[model samples]
Structures are given as C-alpha cells and as structure tokens.
Target: MSLRAILLITLQQEPGTGYDILQRFKAGLAHVWQASHQQLYRELDRMRGDGLLTCETVPQAERPDRKVYHLTAAGGEALDTWLAEPLAAGPVREPLFAKFFAWERWPADARRRELGDLHEQLTQRLATYAAIEEEWFAAPERLTPAQRAPWHTLRLGQRLTQTWREWIEEVLEEGE
Candidate 1:
C-alpha cells in the first residue's frame, strides 16, 4: 500500500496533529513497513498540496503551534477506493535470507549466533504483540477488531519468525 493511502485512512479514522499521526502510524505498522518521521511529515505536506488533507493550526501557550490534519472529502473517497482495490501480489524479500544464501563462508558458530539473535528479536516481538493484545482487550471498540487487522499482521510476523527459529533449531540438531 502506498504511504499516501495509509496516511489518508489514518486521517479519516481520526484527525490529529502531525505528531499524533506520526506516532500512531509507527505503532500500527512501523515494525514491518518502517517509515521514518521525516517521510511521514514530508508526505503530509504533499498530501496537503494535493487537496487530500486539510490542516488547522492551533496556537499553544506552552509550545510551538501545532498543525492538525483531517482528511478532505476527496481524501476519504480515495481511501475507500484504495481499500476496496485488490492488493498487489509481490514476492517476499528477506535480507537475512539473501545473506544466508551465500553464507557458506561464514563459520558455523557465526551462523548459530545469528540465529540466536533472530530468536531473541522474535521473542521481543511476541512480547510486543502480547502488550497490544492487552490494550485491545481493555478498550474493545477504540479501533477495528484486533484479530482482523493489526493482530493479523502481528500473527504473520510471529509465524514467520517462529518458522525461521524452527529451521535454525533443526539445523543445529542435525549438526549442520
């Protein structure tokens, strides 16, 4: 999905300051999509120029003025259209897999260490998903069904991570 479409959906769901959108977007998909704050802010400007979103500047006594963005009617329509469209089918790309493809030169211990590191990272991600699960349960209706959306994405990540962990464990057990 284009970042523009994501931004539009977010604004349509709940209008907010650039900072608010930035944080929320990160929490939503940063683990997988990984957009920087700069990328989002810059896109916000571009969307504004294209009439997809509107900004209201609010003066603040304690800090710099804030620009909160809301999706225009056009933006909402655009998001709906994008949501209805079929998602593109693309090949999966994993840098680690690419590296490991030519990893015969790396020592066995080094490969094992890499696998251990990946396992640790996956454990941390599983913990993160547990935290999100708690929050979704606490506020049942604040967002879409966690099982249908973000949780689905998290599940994909967890499944892939666990699959790799299993493969690594098999390699170790077989004395590869």
Candidate 2:
C-alpha cells in the first residue's frame, strides 16, 4: 500500500501532528510498515496538496508551531475504497532468504557465523515485540476501539517472528 493510504488511515484513527504520527509508527506500526521521518513528512505534504488532508497550525510557546493533520472527507472515502478493494499477493522480498540461497558459496565457518548472527538479530526483534505486546495488555482500559486492527496486526508480527526464530533454531540444530 502507498504511504498516503497509511497516513490517511492513521488520521482516520485520530487527528495528529506529524510528530505524533511518527511516534505511533515507532510505538506499534514499525513492526508492519517502516517509514522514516523524511518519508512521512514528504507524504504529509503531498497528501495536503492532494486535498486528502487538512492541516491546522497550533501555536506553541517556546517552540515551533505544530501542524496537526485531519483526514478530509475525500481522504476518508479514498481510504474506504482502498480497503474494499481485493488485495493481490505481493512478491516475497526477504533478505534472509536471499542470503541463505547464497550460503553454499561461503566457507563452513562463515555459514555458521551468519546463522548465529541471524539468530541473535531475530531474538532481539522478538524481545522488542514481546515488550510492545506486554505494554498493550498492561493497559486494556486505555486502548481505543481503533486499536483493534493494529492489535491483530501486532499478533501476526509476534507469530511470524516466533516462527522465524523456531525455524532458525531448527536449522542451527541440524547443522545446516
């Protein structure tokens, strides 16, 4: 999906400043869609120009004005239409799989080292996701109705990470 659609969905959840949206990505959506601050800011500007969003500057004391964005009617309709469309399967583009395909060319020691490194990285990521999950469950009362979909996505991320970790462990045990 385009970043525009993501941004619009975010705004549909609630109006927010650019920074607020960035925080939302870091807090939860990073597990699914990764975007840099530059990309988000650029897309926000483009969305504004496209009349998909309306921005209002909120004055601040001792700081620059904050431009809060809201989804326009057109934006909401666009998001709804996009949501209703059938999804096509995107091509797989996993770097780890690509690296594994080239593993035979590496020395045996290098192959072991690569697998060890992969295991470590996956472990760390799973830890991070676990912490986010814990935080979510810690405050069930604070979660808005809008969070249900992202919560489901978070569960998928957790499951995918767990599956990858288990597969890596199996490979390591098999001396592959």
Candidate 3:
C-alpha cells in the first residue's frame, strides 16, 4: 500500500500532529509500512495540498507551533474507496533470499554465522509480537469491533514470522 493510504488510515480515528502520528506509526503501523521522518512530513504536505486533509497550526507555551491534521470528507471517501479495492500483493525484495540463492559463494562457516544472526533477529521479532499480544489482546473475545481488526492483523504477522522462524531452524539444523 502507498504511504498516502497509510496516512489516511492513521488520521481516520483521530487528529494528530506529525510527531503524534509518527509515534503511532512506530507502535501500531510499523509492521504494515515504515517511512522516515522526512517522508512522512512530505506526504502530509502533499495530502494537505490535495484537500484530502486539513491542517491547523497550534501554538504551544514554550515550543514551536505544531500542525495537526484532520481527515476531510474527501479523505474518508478516499480511504473507503481504497479499502474496497482488491489488494494486490506488493513486491517481495528480500536481500537474504539473494544471499541464499548464491549460497555457494560463501564459506560454510560464514553461512552459519549469518544464519545464526538472522535466527536471533527473527527470535527477537517473535518475542516482540508475543509481548504485544499479551499486553493488547490477552482476551480477544472481549475486544470491541474496532479492536478486533488490529488483533487479527497481529495474528497474521505472528503466524508468518513463526513460519519463517521454523524454516530457519530447519536450515540451521541441516547445516549442523
């Protein structure tokens, strides 16, 4: 999905300054999409220009003025339209896949070291997903409709990461 679509989704529930939106991205949307600070501000500016979003300048007591963005009617419609459209899978460009494709170029010991590092990274990612599940979705049956959507997305991520971790384990064992 495009960053524009992601921004629209984020601003739908509430109005937020750029910083506020970035914070939410880190906590909520990082798995779906990631953008740098500059990229976010640039997209926000473009959305404002397109009349999909409205920005207001708010003055703080001791800080520089901040701009808060609110989704306009057009923005909501755009989100709805995009949501209804069939989602095509985006391109998967994984560097590790390339590395493995040329596996004979590397020594066995080096390959083992790289696999070990990758395994650790995936392990950490799984731990993070588990913690998020524990804290946010401990009782899925009790969640509101709004909350259920995100919980399902989290579950999808967990299963995908788990599959990758399992494969990595098998490959590592084979090399051992």
Candidate 2 — worst ten consecutive residues by lDDT sum?
A: 136-145
For model 3, how does the per-residue alpha-carbon lDDT over 118-157 read when each residue is reduced to its tens digit? 8888789888888878877899999999998888988898
Highest lDDT: give the candidate number: 3
**Rank order (by TM-score, best first):** 3, 2, 1
Which candidate would rank higher by lDDT, 1 or 3? 3
In model 1, which regions exceed 4 Å deviation?
30-32, 138-149
Q: In terms of TM-score, which candidate is strongest? A: 3
Cα RMSD (angstroms) for every candidate in the order listed: 3.0, 2.6, 1.6
Clashing pairs in 1: none
| lDDT ranking from best candidate downward | 3, 2, 1
* Tens-place lDDT digits, model 2, residues 1-176: 87887898778889999999988888877888888889999999999999999999999999999999999999999999999999898888887687777767767787778778988888898888888888865565577877666777877888888888899788778885
- Global lDDT scores for all candidate models: 0.77, 0.85, 0.89
C-alpha TM-score for every candidate:
0.83, 0.86, 0.92
Scored by lDDT, model 1 comes in at 0.77
Error of 1 at 125 (Å): 0.3
lDDT of 1 at 35: 68
Range of the 10 consecutive residues with the lowest summed lDDT in candidate 3: 25-34
lDDT of 3 at 23: 89
